[model samples]
Each structure stands twice: as C-alpha cells, then as structure tokens.
Target: MLPSTYRDLLRTPGAAAFFLTAAVGRVGIAMTSLGIVWLVHGRTGSYALAGLVAGGFAVAEAVAGPQLGRLIDRYGQGRVLPPVLAAHAASVLALLVLVAEGRPGWLMAAAGAAAGASIPQLGALSAARWSALLRDGRAAELPSGFALESLANGLAYLAGPVLVSAVGAGGRPEVGSVLAAGLVVGGGLALAAQRRTAPPPAVTGPRTARSKASAAVGPRAGRSLVRPGFVVLAGLNLAIGVFFGAMQVSVAAFAVEHGVPGAAAPLYAASSCGGLLTGWLYGLRRWRAAPRVQLVVGTAALALGCVPLLVAGSLPGMGVSVALTGMAVPPILVVATVLTEATVHRHVLTQAFTWLNSASAAGSAVAAAASGQAVDAFGAHGGIAIAAAATTAMAALAAAGSRTFGPPAAKRGGGFGSSAPKRGGNFGRSGGV
Candidate 1:
C-alpha cells in the first residue's frame, strides 16, 4: 500500500496533477535516447551511426539543460515551458522525418541535437515547485517529495526501454519515437497549464545583499554552478552517474559471458526494483541523521554494495549485488535534493537541480566510454571494477566535504539536520528512522 506520507503529499491541491504530468514527461524523456538509437539503427542499419546520433543528443541535452533551467528560473515555468516544449516537439518531428528519408547522419544528428536542446528539465523544475510549495511551513515533507521524484525517475528508466522495445517490435522504430515525442509535448503542456503550482519567476529586486550581488554579477551570474555547494553535489552526482553507466554495460557483458544474454534485462530490473522499494521506505520515516550524514552513509553503502559485483560468479549473485547497490541509490539522491534545496537560494533552485542532472549526464557519457574500453580489454569484471571505483570516489568526496553540504544555520531547525523543535512535523527530527 502507498504510505500515508505520499498520500498526504498527493492530497496537496494541484500536486497530483503536476506530479502525474511530470511523470509522463519524464518517461518520455527516458525513451528519447533509446528511441533515437532504435530509429536510426533501423533506418541506417549502422549501430555506429545510431550510437553517434544518440551521443550527440545526450551531449546536447547536457549542455543545454542548465541554460534552459536558468530561463525557467528567471521567467517562470508557465512562460518558459511552452515555447521550449514546442521546440522539442518540432525537433523530434524533424528527427523522425530525417530518419525516414535516410538523410545524412550529420543532419540526423543535428535534428536530434535540436530535440535534445529543447528537452525540459522537468524533474528539476518539479523539485523547484515542491520547494516553493512546502518550504514555508511543510519543509519536512521535502525529503519525501524528493524521494518520490527519484522514484519517478527510476521507474521511467526502468519502463522506458521496455516500452520502446515493445513499441518498436513491429519493426517501425519511428512509431516509438513518435510516441515519446507526443508524451513529452502533451505532458509538458499540461504541466505548464498548472500555473498555480509553478514557482514564480525569481524576484531580482535590490532588496538584499544576495540580490545586489546577483545584480552586480550580471543577469546570468547567480547560477548555482558557481556555488561551492553545488559543485560538491555535482561531483557526487557525477560519480553516481559513473556507477550507473558502468553497471549498465557491465551487467550486459556479464549476462553474455554467462551465456544468458537475455538475463541482463532482469538483472538490471532487480536493481531498479530494489531502488524503488527502498526509496519508498526512506521517505516513510523521519531520520535523526543530518542530510550530510545520510549522504555519506548512502555513498559508503553504495561503494560497499558494489564490492559484491567483483566476487559474484553467477547471474543470480550479480543480481543480488546490484540490488543491494541500488538500495543506496535513492537515499543519496533524496539527501542531495534536500541539501540542494537548503543550500541554494530559492530563486536559482531549479538551475541548481538541473546542473546536477547535467553533471550526472556528463559523467554517464564519460563512464560509458571508459567502461566500454575496459569491457573490451578486461571483460565484464573490468567494467564492474570501474563501477566500484566510481562509487568509492563518491564516498570519498562525501566524507571529505561533508561540511560543505550542511544547510544554512537558519534552515537547520525545521529542515534537514536540525535538532530544534519541529514546527510543521516530525519529519526532520533526529530520532528513529
């Protein structure tokens, strides 16, 4: 059964609508890269070209995400989302047409880039809205809300590829691409329409020192990327991404080595299932540990969990190991989100979250290349080793810079890591879970 916390969250007026829309949009976003690969590979019969196209798309999105996020933060979601989504839809259609007509690979890649550049950072935007809605009084609910977003992300990735595969089974990969495009456009528009839920445009009036500093730095200066806390979080997320990318490739290679290539899907699904279950559980309880403490613990657990992959000789062993590793994933993300919301100025919160996403995407790209090389040279074990090392790096970073992740002194009382009296609820109190 769904927990009461989540139930209460959904009961918040306008929450259910935006959450559902964001989920749909996120699923579409997940499908896009795979959909591009399928479509291009089907049309060109060249895995290399398909990979190139998909890589271009990923790079484009990573590059453009923070900038788009800045615009959203500055102008507000209702004003910014519509035009961006429209561009995304148009670019997707262009990519589909290019694939159908057997256009040059570079041209197809360009279309994909256009599509990627316009993709909305819905997860980050949604988190920003939650911050706006709950920060004043219901701040304790923030972790649960972040956990729910992370769960949505995990589910999207888990289901997106399967849906793409199923939809493209008829050999018309373009159909899946079309479906992905439709969901993104439709969901984004619906989310935009929920104006009441969207965070207001950042007020840049010269009322405070921060605002004055932002003004001094020029219009684009208050970007979350410039902050040290954001940098720390981005590095941690990048390491997490390395773990993800390496795991994906290594698990497949392991399945192939065991002469059960099809087992890869189930093995990977085990990890996702584990993450989903634990993410829900993590959200249900109030924790005594600070967000920084939770982050360090989560990263350490993730590193240790990957250790089993090195020794797992059988498919089932690998599944168990990956599942354990996955259990640590969501809590880390939830903690990161909490810390980000606490540390970043609310005006730039959306940009901060999107920058984290961009960091993870960049890390995934780097890890994919490195893991592919390792797998080719040292087999699946090499990739698994890389995964473990990445998580270990994440743990090291978290421990070394734990102080940097602390919320501002003022926010500590009612939010994460506070010992003060609870104003809204017991969600952030230091105690049992």
Candidate 2:
C-alpha cells in the first residue's frame, strides 16, 4: 500500500503529470550509455572503441550537466527544455546515421558527445520542483518525494539495460538507441508542458543600491560549487559513485570467477531490491537526527557494508554483502537531497543538485577504469577492495565536514514540518556561506 504522504503528494496539482513524465525521461537517460556501447560494439566489432565512445559520452554529460542546470535555473524549464531536447534528439539521430554509414570512430564519438551534452538533468529538475511544492507546512513530505525520485531512478536503471540488451540480442542494436532517443524527447516535452508546476527562475536583475552596498561589503558570492558545505557533499557523493562503479564490476567478476556467470544479474538485482526497500522505508518516518548526522552515519554504515564484499567467497555470501551495501546508498542520497535543499539558494537549487549528479558521474567514470585495471592486475577481490576503500574515504569525508552541516531540527527549534521565515526562508542559507 502506498503511504498517505505519497498519496497526498501525488494528489497535489500537476504533481502526477510531471513526476510521471520525468520518470519516463530518466529511463531514456539510463538507456543511452549501454545502448551506445552495444550499438558501437555490434557495428564495429571492437570493445575498445565501444568503451571509449561510451566513456566519452558519460564524461561529456558530466561536464555539461552543471552548466546546463545553471541555464535551466536562470531561464526556467519551459523556456530551456524544448530547445535542449530538440538538440538532443537531433544529435542522437546524427549518431545513428553516422554509425549506419560505417563512419570513422572519432566522428561517431563526437556525435555521441553532442547527444550526451544535451541530455536533460530531469531527475535533478524534478527534485527542485518537489522542494518548491513541499515547502512551508508541507516540508515533511519532502523525504517521500525524494524517495520516490530515487525509486524512479532505480526502476529506470533496471528497465533500460534490459530493454537495450533485449533489442540488441535481436540483432538491431541501433533500434535501442532510437527508442531511447524517442523517450528522452517525448518525456522531456511532457515535463516541460507542466508549466504550472515549474519553479520560478531565479531573479538575476540589476541589484538595487542597498543590495549592491551589502554585496560590496561582504565576500563575493560565486557558483554553488564553491559554497562551503556543498563541496563536501559533492565530494562525498563522488566517493559513493566510486563505490557504485567498483561494486558493479566486482560483483560481475566474482560471479564469473565462481563459474556462475549468469548469477551476476540476480546478485546485482538483489542489491537493487535492497536499496529500493530501504529507500521506501526511510521516507516513511521523520527522524530527529540532524541531516549532517544522518549523512555521517549513512557513510559509516556504507563503509562497513562494503567490508563484507572483500571476504565473500561464494555467490550467496556476496549477494548478502552486496544487498547490505546497497541498503546504505538511498538513505545517504535522501539526506544529501534534504541538505542540498536546505542549504542552497532557491535560485540555484537545481544547479546544485546537478553538481552532485555530475560529481557522481565523474567518479563513476574514473572508478570504472581504475577497477577494471585492478580486476585485471589482482582479480575480482581487487575491485572489491577498491569499493571498500572508496566508502571509507566517503565516511572520512563526511566525518570531517560534519560541523559545516547545520544543526538538527531540535536545535533549530523545529521539526521537518516547521515553516521557515518568509523573508529569507530556510530554502537557502545564502548568507551563511
């Protein structure tokens, strides 16, 4: 049964439309990387070139995400998404055409890069909308909203690979790319159509004399990346990304090493199931712990969870360990979303969220390469070791920056349901940085 909070949230005007559409759009985003890899490899018969092209796509998306998010924040979704989605569609078509013609690998990679650079950050944008909708007295619903978003992401991840792989197995890998492209454009446009729910663009007009005077007196504010606590959050998420990348490779390698290569998918699915279950449950209750404290504990738990992976000699044992590890991920992400919403300026909230996504993408790309090397040099256990090391670094980073994260709701004299002051609401600690 759905929780009342989730039911109530979906009942909000335009909520169901945007959420449903964004969920659809994210499935496309999830499909693109694997689709590209399959298409390229099938066409060219070179895993090396396929991986390079796919890696370039990921790196381009990570590089472009924050800048695109900043534009979305400044111009609003209605004004920005249409053109961006159009470009994405066009670039994807170009990629397909280039591949069909047996074009040079570099040309195909460039086309993939263009497609990736324009992929919308739908999940982050949806999160920003939830923040705007659930503000004031409805703040308690924020966690549930974020949890639903995380679940949507998980579902998309699961569906995308299956869909792409199934199509590829039928001997037309390019069809998967086409399907992903269509979904990305269609879902993005659907979300953009929900203009009523879109957050207002940040006011970037000329500063008034009084505001200018204050700005002159205070430290000059820059982008969200430079914000005090935000850097720590981004760093922690990067490490979490490393854990994800390493864990994926390690589990697959372990399964193959034990002569049960087919077991890899089910084992990873176990981790996903654990994450979805915990994320759903985590959103159901309001915790008294500070966001910072939750983050610290979450990272610590994740670190401990990864430790078991290093020692698991059997598939069943590894499944249990991976599931435990997956259980820790969603809560950390939920807390990170809560904290980002609380601390970032409302104007740049979407961009702030994108920065975290970008960080994770960057980390994942790096870890995938590093873990591949480790797996080659020292076998499956080496990859597991890398996963554990990443989580430990994440925990250490969380502990070090614990102080910068603001006090708990109790200290602030309010709980999750409490409203912020109207003038400079808790939405952004703009001056606190």
Candidate 3:
C-alpha cells in the first residue's frame, strides 16, 4: 500500500497550496520546449533552424538559473519571484507573436531565450520550502517530499507536451504559449503569497576563519556555494541529464527507423510511467543507505538497465527497456535533493538546488548536440552508447564521493525552522498564505 506520507505533508499549513501551484507552473514550463520547436519548424520548414533555436533557449536558461537563484537567496521569494515571472510571461507572449507574424529567426530565438531565462526556478523553490518546513526531527520526511517532486516532474513531462499539442491542434500553435503564460503568472502569484514557509537568508559579512573552515569542512550552516560536496553532487545530476538527453534522441531515432514515428510518445511515456510508479513506492518507506551510497547504486542500476537497449529491435522491446531503465531515475534525483539540503545552509538552499538545475541543463544541452551528430553518423545504437557512457561516468563519480557524504562536521543547534528571520526583509510579515 502507498503510504499516507504525502497526505500528512499536505496537511501541514500552506503545503497544499504551494504544491498545487508549483505543479501547474511546472506543467506549463514543460510545454515550452516542444512548443518552441514545433512553432519554429512550422514557420521555417527547417529542422536545423528549429533545433538551433531550441538549443539557444536551453543554454540561456542554464546560464541564468544560478544567478536568479542567488537573487532569490539574498532577497526573499515573495520579493524576487513576481517580477521575474512577469518578465517571463511577457517574453513568452513576445515569442509567440513574433513566430505568428513570421519574424526573423534571430528575433524568435532572442525572445525564446528571454522566456527560458526568466522561468521561475519553481522546482528548486518548492524543495527549499519543504526543506524549511521539515527541519528538526521531521527531517526524515524529506525523502517523501523529494519523491513528490520527482513525481511532479515525471507527470509534467508526461502531460505537458500533450497539452501543447492539444492547444496547437488544427493549426493554432500560438495558443499554447498564451496558455503557458497564464499558468506561469497564476502559479507564481499563488506561491509567492505563501510567505510563512520562506527560508531566512544566511548571514553574509567579511570572511572569517570559522566561516571559511565550515565551508571547507562539513557544517550544515556553512556557506554551501563554496563547498566541494555540493559541486560533486551537482556533477552527478549533470551526468544524469546527459543520460536523459541521449536516451531521448535514441528513442526518437529508433522509432523513426522502425517506420512508426508516432510511437516515440508512447515509448517516452512508458519511461515516465515507470519513474512515477517507483517514486510513489520510494516515498512509502524511509531510506537506510547513506545518500552517497544510494547515488552510486542508483546510477549503476540505470546503466545496467540500459544494457538491454543494445538488443532492443522493435518498439515494444525498446519500450520495455526504457521503462526498466527509468525505474532507477527518481531515486537518484531524490538522493541528490537530500544531499543538496544536507550540504547547503537553509538560507541558500534554493541557490544550491538551482545550481543542480543549471548543471542538468548544461549536460542536456551538450548531450543534445552530441547525440544529434552521433545519431546521424551511427544511428540509434550510437545514442544508446552515449547514454550508457554518461550513466557509467555518473556512477564512478558517485562512488568516489561516497566517503564525503555524512553529517556536517560542526553541529548547529536546532533546525532552520526554529531560526527567527530578520525584520524588514522582503515578503513582509508571514500570513496564513
């Protein structure tokens, strides 16, 4: 039976509102990539141009993500989120208008990049809220929270493209972007209203030995951006992104080769379904292995699962392989989220998560370019080889970092939930939101 942990978490003040809003926003963001690609292809009739513009959007987002997260860390979410989201909505509208009006490709790419850069770091923000709320003895509940995030992400990928296609049905692709903008605006406002769960900012001042030492060594309250532990964790997520990107290209290529291009969606859906089911089961039980061990083991399992892809000849065979391979994905993500929370101070927690997000985006961008070349030269086999190689690299890195994952060296009393935030900061006084 699935545990009622999610229900219990939802029962907490503001959790339900925040999560629902986050989900709506996430689904909208998911739609943008496919929508952009389709819109560009429709306008230009060149797959190369469409792919290039889409790549530019992803690259811009990856570059801007950390900087935005830093702003959110320094200022509070309520202060920082609304303006960025507004800009994002405007950018989306601009891109849709330009595409519909047959504007130059450069102009379209520019607008798309703006929209991508301004996408609210909703996943990272939600995790940080849950981290703040679950501090102290309730820390064990974090795995369940992270699992919920994984489920949301899986669902978004599964459903978002469908929504985009439906909106674009019968020659109306621009409607998709309009709908996405509305969802982003609505969700951002709703989440920003929930100031009660916002984490306090970390102390920033002239560097001291204690601060420097804590940053170098393990201390939960240490400045996390400087820590090697967080760097390694981010690297692991980057590798996971490479595997994901390569697998996607490989699946699309395989489906095309089999003369069933439409089968790509079902094949990808199989993987998402597998991840979603495992996420539910994973959250039902408390974890035992150290996060480091789990990261290594989960990565290794993913690589092993992909081995079947080498022999998969038909769509059904590939679908089964993809599903089995995807089962290992959510656990790695959940462990990575837990590790990020453990290494970073609560104040900068959102920034740390955004760094991971950036790393993943970078990895995906690199993989997409490389996999495209490989698929053209050596077909789907080459793409699967890339996926396997990336996962193997991730496993190796995780194993090397195993000894580094543990409780912080210096003990900080109480939890972040117990810390009193400074007065006159952004977001004003906490309310029932």
Mark the regions of model 3 whose C-alpha exceeds 4 Å error after superposition: 1-4, 43-49, 203-223, 406-411, 417-433
lDDT of 2: 0.80
Q: Which ten residues in a row have the lowest lDDT in candidate 1?
A: 424-433
- TM per candidate comes to 0.91, 0.90, 0.88
- Counted clashes in each candidate structure: 2, 0, 0
**What shift in Å separates residue 349 of candidate 3 from its native position after superposition?**
1.1
The local distance difference test score of each candidate is 0.81, 0.80, 0.76
Residue pairs of candidate 3 with colliding backbone atoms: none
Model 2 lDDT per residue over 364-399, tens place: 778888999999999999998999999999999999
In angstroms, give how far residue 92 of model 1 lies from its true place: 0.9
When 1 and 2 are scored with TM-score, the better candidate is: 1
lDDT of 3 by residue, 209-282 (tens): 65454344333433556767777888887888898889889999999999999999899889988988988788
State residue 349's C-alpha deviation in candidate 2, in Å. Answer: 1.1
Highest-TM-score candidate: 1
Tens digit per residue, CA lDDT, model 1, 1-433: 3355788998998888888898899899989999999999998899999998898889899899988988887768988899999899999999988888988999998998998899988888777777767756666677778887888888888888889988777798998999998888898899999999888665455587765664554454364346666678888989888888898899999999999999998998899899899998988877766777778898998988988899999998999998999888888888887877766655566777888888888777888889999999999999999999999999999998877754444355453223222333233311000
